[model samples]
Target: MDDAIQTEPVRQKKQKTAAGGSKAGTAERRGTDVTRVSEVSLSSKRAATAPIAVLLAAAVLLAGCWDSREVNELAVVMAAAIDQADEQNIELSVQVYNPRTAGGGGQVGQMSGGSGGGAGAFVVRSAVGSTMADAMSKLQEKLPRQIFWGHGEVFVIGEAVASKGLREHMDFLLRSPEIRDKADVFIVKGKAKPLLTLPVPLEGNTAQTMGKLADIHLGVQVSIINLTRMLAGSARGAILPLVQLSQSEEKAGDSGKIPFMTGAGVLKNDKLIGYIDVATMRGAMWVRDEIELATVTVTPTRTERGDVTVRLVRSRTKLVPRIEDGKWAITVESEAQGDILQNTTNVDFGNPLLAGRLEQDFNDQIERRMTGAIEKLQKMNADVLGFSQAFHRRYPKEWNKVKDRWDEQFPHVQATAVVKVKIERHGLSSSGAVRPNDEVQAE
Candidate 1:
């Protein structure tokens, strides 16, 4: 039995050795297979990325700023002026933003507020050519840097240029992709170039100052798009804010002469026909529903001593077109709310009867202004107030019949003004300070 046990242990040892040899061979085969798979994967990855790498390199080499323009190499036009040079030629003046003036700070900043005509923040460059496009091309040739129109904000037309016609300049402005349609347009009493050269003591440049003035709505405000719509409308009548150099007491040259809105230029058939004074322009604004701020002073019929002034808090106007028995007429319906600003009259606002009378007086004053403006418009035969559009909206068929003869028919169409005013607020004190109880008229 001892011999048998020793022989069995020897056999088991042999079997264990064979099993270890088989396991070692199997592990060796598995390692070889894994190495081969890894080599194939690495080779495939390199092959796949080689073409992409080459394309990227080629793209980098081909990409160069051939068509790009540097900011320093461009002349930025802020404002443009068109003037009648002669019968055969036209002049184009551009206000170029000087790059040198930028970051120099006080030199350009002081330019706006300075009382003398010093080296300005902008440079005015002019060129003459037969047409606007030609003038622009020539102007570009005159400057070393490329002319850029992206920042052009104000367009000023000289009185002579406007009187001649706006079609040529307007067409060029509208077609150019760089020109903004919302740029404010103006008509200067003299040369537009002079207006651009004038030093304004309020804003960065004269263009910005002009833009702010237009925004304040002191007078008639007409943008390129506004003018386009008006001209394209059935009325074909347009108005532009008229600018003139202020006649200051101090003759500090162009620097002292501030550009102020004098009135409005009336355009008919794209030609400037006439102008309306500031008061008349205010009346026109009422008819056109463009009144933003206004102060009205009227003498109450009951009191002949002094005049009462009111500041308009809110005002709205609606043109009601009436067609009856083949006759055309328009009713100017206006509603306004105002606060008593000054009361020179000896009256107590607490009295409803007296307030009613004052309200009536306000209505009468507004009516007179509206009727007077309408009469002037009729006399000029220019329908800048959009009367034609009103009639067309209400009576399309009748308007079409008389649309061609609108200029002739406009004068005959009677316009009636109906104004309604409400004295919403009378000052903190109801009675005047100067007038005592004896003079205070109470109902």
Candidate 2:
């Protein structure tokens, strides 16, 4: 305001001088105008300097404040295993990556049994406490650096820990900010520590190897976030991939042990109720629309011994729930398409009639598997497929009345499974190449 107010009079005097005074006086007034304008410019520049300096200082002070732990300062947790120590305490084992040589694509090496034993990678440490968090703190007490879970790929629950309740011990994972959402959840057949300590030939770390298995769609992939979501959803139950330590083909040494994903563990209300075979687990996976790449072998008839394997290319399943006459029922309809990878039967599937029969047989096989899976789950009083969710979505009002008694009602709930399989393509040959040409049946 002062600069403008003072400059206005200068402009008026300059105009007056231009009209009456000599050229010398006009030039002097113009010089005074330039000086005033320069003063205003300098004043504004000086005023902006303070705020700019303050902002710089603030940024500098806040440089390393938010989640600024260096890699060297952290023990990058590759995996975690939980087991029951005693009646009151729990054992927590973590595979902390040795940051000294963890970087680069090379496999990390560690001494599992002893220094002179087989070469193993990663350090497996254990701690026992009353709770998961307590056990974690105990484990951290022996570490030189803070444990970072951002790199953790999987968490394996021992048979004992799973038999107990997982809901009570899941608080740390649910509440921690550093825990990754995609960390896979697994249930080991025996102790989880042995599985983690095993040296896998293909992948150095067994937990990381399990992550790749899930990614490749070899087994059901249930992440930490997904597990909680499924349990909280209408399902009220969950399933986790089951891992076990298998003997290596070479020898039975400390380094010759490998971890293999065998089956799935069933959980009802956060407690492991039972286990399912891999074959049966596939059926459940189909009902849950979780099977991505699987080969289903079904015989065309009971009398035939030849196997007809179909590679599941794609599949979709829909569970529709309804209430009729106060009776709850769910109908599962699934459609799948596959290519015949191996057909050893005498019948040529290229023919329409044989193809139709094959389709019907495949459909029956799928439905049978689904029926068996549903029966097993129903027997266990577990709704792992979220059938209750369907009912809740379809009949929200009626669902509220029976949700409390879902376990009792689920066992008696009427369910029908319908599956349709289409043989999209037969391999390169129209007939089974293995069969002799003289014994071939055209149609």
Best by TM-score: 2
> Which run of 10 residues does model 1 get worst, by summed lDDT?
109-118
After the best TM-score superposition of candidate 2, give how far the Cα of residue 305 lies from its true spot, in angstroms.
5.7
> Against the true structure, what is each candidate's TM-score?
0.81, 0.83
List all candidate RMSDs to the true structure: 9.8, 8.1
Q: Predict model 2's lDDT versus the native.
A: 0.82
Top lDDT model: 1
Candidate 2: tens digits of C-alpha lDDT, residues 105-224: 435645444112233357778888999889888878878889889889989999888888888767778888888988989898768877777667677778778888788877788999
User: lDDT of candidate 1?
Assistant: 0.86
Q: Which digits, one per residue and each the tens of the lDDT, describe model 1 over residues 176-239?
A: 9989999999998868888777666667567988989889888888889899888888878999
